[model samples]
Target: MADNQLGEFLRARRGAVSPDTVGVPAHGARRVAGLRREEVAVLAGVNADYYARLEQGRERRPSAQVLDALGHALRLDPDARAHLHRLAGTAPVLPLGRTPDRVSPALRRLLDGFPGSPAYVVNRTLDVLAANTLAEVLHSPFSDLDNLARMTFLDPAGRRFHTRWDRTAQAVVGHLRESSGLDPDSPRLRALVRTLCADSPDFAGLWHTHTVRGKTHDAKHFLHPDVGPLTLTYLALDVRDAPGQQLIVYQAEPSGPDAEALALLAALA
Candidate 1:
């Protein structure tokens, strides 16, 4: 992790914002992309020097109100705004270090219950903590299903398995960014990120974007070797007892082609 994550986030997000989007008139040719520091200060309703200090790491703590204003100026979404607050030290931080690796018996039962569906448990780092039989079958293409990041970037089968590889890459990177903001001191996360960045140029480029998101309800498209093409909608639920654990279940519509594919896959499993 970078020493000055707050500054790094601010700088990266600042560069991402378009001057035209914020109504900052582009006078002529500008040396730097995005809005200038002074423009951001004006939009955020703060002194230019103060904002500069905030970005340079000379000032660390910022009030919630100021962080809100900055978030607005940066055009951050709910997740990104929360990430900004976290970076500014205004948001409540999670307990330092890695979360518990064990998945609860109840969750394991839930996964087992979904014999027709593909279900799995993953932590903030996207480690496949626990998976149902169907999920194991669904992800059998990967060399190892231990960590999703590794599977997506390191394994050759990831690109072939995921129909929308580009979108999957973005979602994985965004999820990592969201997790890192909440638990910055996790050695597991740090090492995983380091390994991915070193080994995969795709991961390295997306990591620098600083996109923050958590897995939620979304449709996933996959190309299975045995079943051909399968599309399933997934719901990601945060385990109430576990702070960072997310239980993801993928389901296909009843009586649909996808459901047939899933059924065939389950039979094979």
Candidate 2:
């Protein structure tokens, strides 16, 4: 990583964004790469000296207001803003490795009970925490993989499985970019990103976009090898008591091919 957490994150996000993104002219004969420190300071409505101190790691603490200003100036999405706070030691430290908190017994039972719908839990970095049998069967291609972001970008079969592969890929990349903001020092996440970037040129290209998006409600189209094409609605529910885990439920439209496909997958499960 870079010298300090804040500096490193700033440097990484800065390089990811172009001057045009922040409304600064891409003038010729620029000295430093990406946005200059003073430019960012000005855009963030802070003194150049203060911004410089923050980026250089000389200043460790920043008020929430200042952080929000900086986040806005950087065009950071929620994930990115949360990441910035974490790097600044504002957010609580998360557990290391894949030792995610166990899914609540209630949630597990819920998944088990809803045999028709595919449901699973994912951590902040898109690590598959747990899945129902049907979820495993429905997302068979991805279940063997640990990280959804990595699978989306690195798996060749992903291209065919995700009908809107390009859009999905971008969304995954954006989500990862947002995550980088929240947990800049997560060694596991950093390693995953490095590995994916090195292995997949598409991942590398998308990472450079510096986009961030949360896993809000979205529609997904799946081309199941056995079930054919199915469209489903994906809902993300923050596990009420489970801080970092999210319950993702996939449901198909009623009385449609998608519904039939779900039934078939459930039977196979």
lDDT top scorer: 1
Best candidate, TM-score-wise? 1
lDDT of 2 by residue, 1-269 (tens): 34476776676666666788789987688877778888888988999999889978999899888888988887777777887887777776564443355877888888788788888888778888788888888777764756788778777678888999988998888777656665666687788888988999998887765556788789998898888898999999887677667888999989988999899988888
lDDT of 1 by residue, 1-269 (tens): 89888888888888889999999998889887677889999999999999999889999998999999998999999999999888887887695445679999988999999999899999989999999999999999888779998999999999999999999999999999998888998898999999999999999999887888878988888999999999999999988788889999999999999999999999999
C-alpha local distance difference test of each model: 0.91, 0.79
TM-score of 1: 0.96
Query: In model 2, where is the ten-residue run with the lowest total lDDT?
Result: 92-101
- Would you estimate the TM-scores of all the predictions? 0.96, 0.77
Error of 2 at 207 (Å): 4.4
**Worst lDDT window (10 residues) for model 1?**
91-100
